[model samples]
Target: MDFNFLSPVSDLVLAHNALLSSQALGSKLRIHSKNQGIPDLDAVGIAIIGVLENRNDVNYIGEEFNLNEIRKSFYGLFPGSWSSVVADLGDIEKGERVEDTYFALKSIVSALLKLNIIPVIIGGTQDLTYATYRAYDDVIPMVNIVNVDCKFDMGDSSKPMKNNSFVGKIILDEPYNLFNYATIGYQTYFNSQEEIDLMDQLYFESYRLGEVSNDISLVEPAVRDANIVSIDLNSVKGSEVSLNQKFSPNGLDGKEICAIARYAGISNKVTSLGIYEYKPSKDDEMTAMLVSQMLWYFIEGVNLRVRDDDFADENSYQKFITLVDSQELIFYKSNKTGRWWIEIPFLADVNNKLKRHTLLSCTHQDYIDACSNIIPERWYKAFRKNSV
Candidate 1:
């Protein structure tokens, strides 16, 4: 993998430290873009996270877009006292890269859970999926995984590897609760027949843009149910913004993609999240700017969801339960699956064998495994605490 050494904003480390020092360091997040921004828009508070570092990757129109400059502009969002995390993988042997990436990946997710900070990872490519799941496992168990992309990304590889093959490796290696996974916006030509076949065999839901209407309601239930979200920009239609090979013209519109992003955020089931394949080299000015805006809106949605208070008394729980239970789902079962195949519906269906739980019995890992369904321990505790 070739690394571009051109980081436009050089004081990122300094800014990162300032943000870290200001936080309570142990409590749940109290700040949000809707409220005061990360550190405060009253000052230069957004600059700390900086903009995304630009490098090489495939994008729409078959070109590379360099984002180094926008990254500099984004740094302006942070105040004088903020910072972002940059994990670099210099040249390492193939066997070592996966484990090494896992280490950095795990640490970042751990920090998110610990510090209440949102992390945006720029890629070495899609194998980051391995790192994302490993870290998520640390905090939650039996959760849903959602991929909003144009390809199954289930490429063939001989061993545990990176690039496109990681998705295939995950499918091959794990005995999944097929219902726990979902894919969207896949274009016809971008995938091979065999890849297409395997993807269909799974129990998870899929929404091909060519086959369905523009309304996301066809697939909104699964997205709402996800515990972790892995969004590949290739899922977007063939526009100047999509920076990945095998892209297609008739994919998802940006507005639709952002709608799903907002939905994922508001559900707050996303414990570990990533949006990959944004080739800075191919993206023009508008594309780069939209990336930041799209991501910010997603966070804002989640912040709104988490901040909005609800109780068993107010009927929000009842409304949520009814809404969730009403969604149409196609179930798939792969033999020799596990003892239990679960879906967490909160108050939606308490009598479900796979639904109800010993209250507060779940660890962070358990909640993540259940995805959008399980209440985060913090949410439960805080709701109870505030109610008291």
Candidate 2:
């Protein structure tokens, strides 16, 4: 993948280029590499993730092209800090370039985890949450999951790209703690009775940006033990971000939005992050430019926290390897019967990908400490005899 032009190639021509190419693409700017190093950030840990590309009528989440500008514009913010993460996945394109963005993202996440780099995942739609969160789910326990969006995304019909609704579907589809739910920046209209009731029953917390002006209190608890943070740009008024589904004049102002993001970035456990609905068709230079800046601030906060002495060696929440020795075996369950079966009992553990995503929570308390360094452990209220 060339730093200048995207690969897997696009039929679109050079004449179509604007934002990043105009200023930074030429000879005047050069990406700082290992030898020279970046002026501000060393990029000890990072990866870039862009899952969305502007689509035509056939696609589910169709939005105009200008949105890609964020990637280009964001590079300009590159040197604003030291040890700030390098945006590694910028080469990933939207739409036709890749099939099943979720799968591709997992591969990228897997590679990064091996490197111990923090991944900053960009949009393909709010649906990116399912895959991004899924990548780290197997690594950490007591995860604090938070959704920063206006809509609860309760749509679960299962068709691809219903855009926002499936967000609820995936969370429900997977088994994360419902008690971990916390939402911010939702206006009154976006809340429904059932959604509220569920949140209440689970002790889920939310703050309506409409009524509260600067309730910074809304952001804290959601990140306490979080190993990942899911950011939906639509959490702010669509007026602030063109990619938003519902734009409004009543959204949280620019200052508050960054503060919240910065706050989220400070969490010790936030490993992977995603930002969605960056549809360029609805965007302008101001919107495009501002978002890139917002990203810079968020990264800055994460960098500061990561660089701190306590967290310096704790970048990734993922730990240990499974099927690690030639003596160990890897297995899977039958799709229909759901019964565990063994495979490859005598393979070397030189580099096992299976261990990267399998979290272990044994029925016994002693199991927690035994596997604590490798498989993340948790205390379960109820134990399923066969569940791993």
Candidate 3:
């Protein structure tokens, strides 16, 4: 339970919290403060941590940033009927080297995960996601990550790690713990053709901005199957965020991004959520308010979570069998939540990563497609990955 790497939330934020309404979220938090030190984490379901390191940002110029405004905005909002306890553990200041910061963040995230406490990280750059992924090396045998971003961020791993290319490092680095990586709201124009081809070849998933914008529910299945969810603020449209934070003229709007965050929160397997690429400006109230609302929605989603994924009891779900071409596709619908899942047959002969029969999350549309003699693309890719 050593959290020496963390610094207490600033006195200014603490003073601000004192003046907030008794029903405000800030008033109910177990805060780590200069006067009280780190708060006890007993029974805490979520911990908020900030990482102040952006040296690896591709556009870095020795600039500095802080999460104080985001915290202020979050504290001012009234809580929903949330059953989960939240604590703000404050920030991890930039270390002497970028790698040092990564090590500290990885350590804190790993400790939180072991305690079954989901860490909601507010970060300086998206590359910090690499550290968070590494934290799962010992905690989980395999991991699935869902990135809400406009670009693939799979820069060349052969070169040094940058915020844009940290995914490449995750793919190439040791432990090989990553089972699946999916990007939602990716802009094709922002990515090169090779990256797109690489995603297909590796069986990784990518959803374009247009497709997801047209139907935000498309994000549910992908996020439902994830272990970690990372969001880059740049995924949001220029009009939705501050000028300094904007990276694209076209991207997810505030409502779309918050919905995605809530989907991440609702996922039972998702243990960590990081919102990165925050840049401060004089007029950052808009962006700060947006980030705070996203956090609020995520917490609300957590409060409403239902354990409907368990299929051990046949009575809990309805089973459907359909034939697509010569292959039999098995679909299960949860009676409680109406969520759909397609089964991936386990292969006994080959070295199977899953080691047993697995159900991949899907939508009702996928079932309709199967009924129409069409195979769901996700099922096909997952099948191929399993066989390999």
lDDT of 1 by residue, 81-123 (tens): 2132222111111223346545655554555544454454544
Candidate 3 CA-lDDT value = 0.94
Query: Which candidate leads in TM-score?
Result: 3
Error of 3 at 117 (Å): 0.5
- Mark the regions of model 3 whose C-alpha exceeds 4 Å error after superposition: none
Query: Model 3 Cα displacement at 217 (Å)?
Result: 0.4
Q: After superposition, how far is residue 142 of candidate 2 from its true place, in Å?
A: 4.8
Error of 2 at 94 (Å): 4.6
lDDT of 2 at 285: 58
Full-model lDDT for every candidate: 0.47, 0.50, 0.94
The TM-score between candidate 2 and the true structure equals 0.63
lDDT of 2: 0.50
| lDDT, residue 244, model 1 | 38
Q: Which pairs, if any, clash in model 3?
A: none
